[model samples]
Target: MTGIAILPAGRDDAFEQYKQLIRDRHPIEDIGSYLNDEDLELFRTTSDDDLVHVWGTSVDGVWRNIERNDIALVYHDGAFVARGQVLQLRHDPDLAEYLWRKNVEHGRWNEEIPWEYMAFLTDIEEVNVDIEEFTELVGYDKTYRQQGFTRVADKRLNQLSGEESVKTVIADLTDAGEHIHPVGDEDDGPTPDLADQLQAASTDGNAHEEFEKLVAKVFSGLCCAADWIKREAYPSPSQPEAGGRPGLR
Candidate 1:
């Protein structure tokens, strides 16, 4: 379980210093009993930002690997979208992350884990309002999130179009209740905020739930279409390995 702290952003010096602070170190130096070839190779190759590849036998028996990305996506409607927004529909940041990492069976920091192995943490978020739309409500009550790897093709994106939907959302939300706009006062738009949809949908009776369902359908369709890209780019072999890696030959 990871917790997010909204501290002020820092300089490159601070980031580098933070990296050094968490640099992996071996308790013992050059002792034959300390480690083995594969283990040392694992440590030497992986960095603070890179997900370590720990494959093969554990030497003690169990073998495993772990990696994480704040967001992943496939090409949908020609764009690259972050995963954080999808999760937001489920709840606030805390609740959203709770659901994303909820399914892991093993802890990354277990002492049993290799001391040389370092973990990586990343958060994928939209930079502007337009990008924010790539993220949306998960359900009527924010029950689930949707996000991942994507290749957004809209030309406006490749260019630095400074549109911020978040600002738009907050503006509309606040205007409706006089409290939400404080968050979105800068943007110029008459569009409805997310809360507006929730309220309007509530009044419309079924619109709230219907809207969320529509979101899921749209995302699923995009993902399904993107899968075909991978299939076309790299066709799968006919025979399959039941529980093992595919054979090259």
Candidate 2:
């Protein structure tokens, strides 16, 4: 089963360092020449890595665990601003040139580093994963502090505090249901209507009554992680595949 993975974009305005490096690589004074000032500011300020080319030399193992088609979230400040699926993992210079050159020209990304490794993402979507809601559900575990890539097992997630509260927050958001899709996933199929989904889940003809079940269905992987833990408490006859995250492996 596919798992959700989190990655830190940067803390504070540290991504600014990367922006400045991009400027140094390619000399461009007028940032507005490529995009408006507001967009330029967003590119510099946001930690969303929709088409980000990262330095992946040391984190090869972590990247390996995050297989293609698994979901990835780019997190910064107190929420996740971007989400995508791993499309490809490669060390191709041509791919880097095509993806980064435009951004470099627009003063958005640093110049291409041919030797740097990268993970390509597709179907990138932007969403808010509120820290308060997240903390209430999972408590303050060391798992959140993980950098690079951290995969939280469903079983581990079940150990967090306030599972009901997390479900409530997810239900509330789903009720307001906004359509979210990545840039290139136009052909993926019709986006499900949140209200319709909730209604289908309702058995007693009450909207609120069905919400909890819908939330559980949506977050089944997270809510049921602990069931796997309960069944297999570790040191089994056969060791399962080691995943990302520090000590869990």
**Every candidate's CA RMSD:** 20.6, 16.7
Off by over 4 Å in 1: 1-64, 69-114, 122-209, 219-249
| Winner by TM-score | 2
CA lDDT, every model vs. true structure: 0.25, 0.42
> Which residue pairs in model 2 clash with each other?
154-225, 155-225, 155-226
**Could you give me the TM-score of model 2 versus the true structure?**
0.40
Candidate 2 lDDT by residue in tens digits, 17-76: 233322122222332354346544543443233123232323455556666655555666
TM-scores of the candidates are: 0.17, 0.40
Q: lDDT per residue, candidate 1, 1-249, as tens digits?
A: 111111111334322322222222112222223345654444444434432211111122110112132122212222322122111111123321221223122213223432232222222332222223333311112332223212222242323223423322322322211111111222222234645654565455424333433333333434421100101022224442255321110
lDDT for position 38 in model 1: 56
Worst 10 residues of 1 by lDDT: 225-234
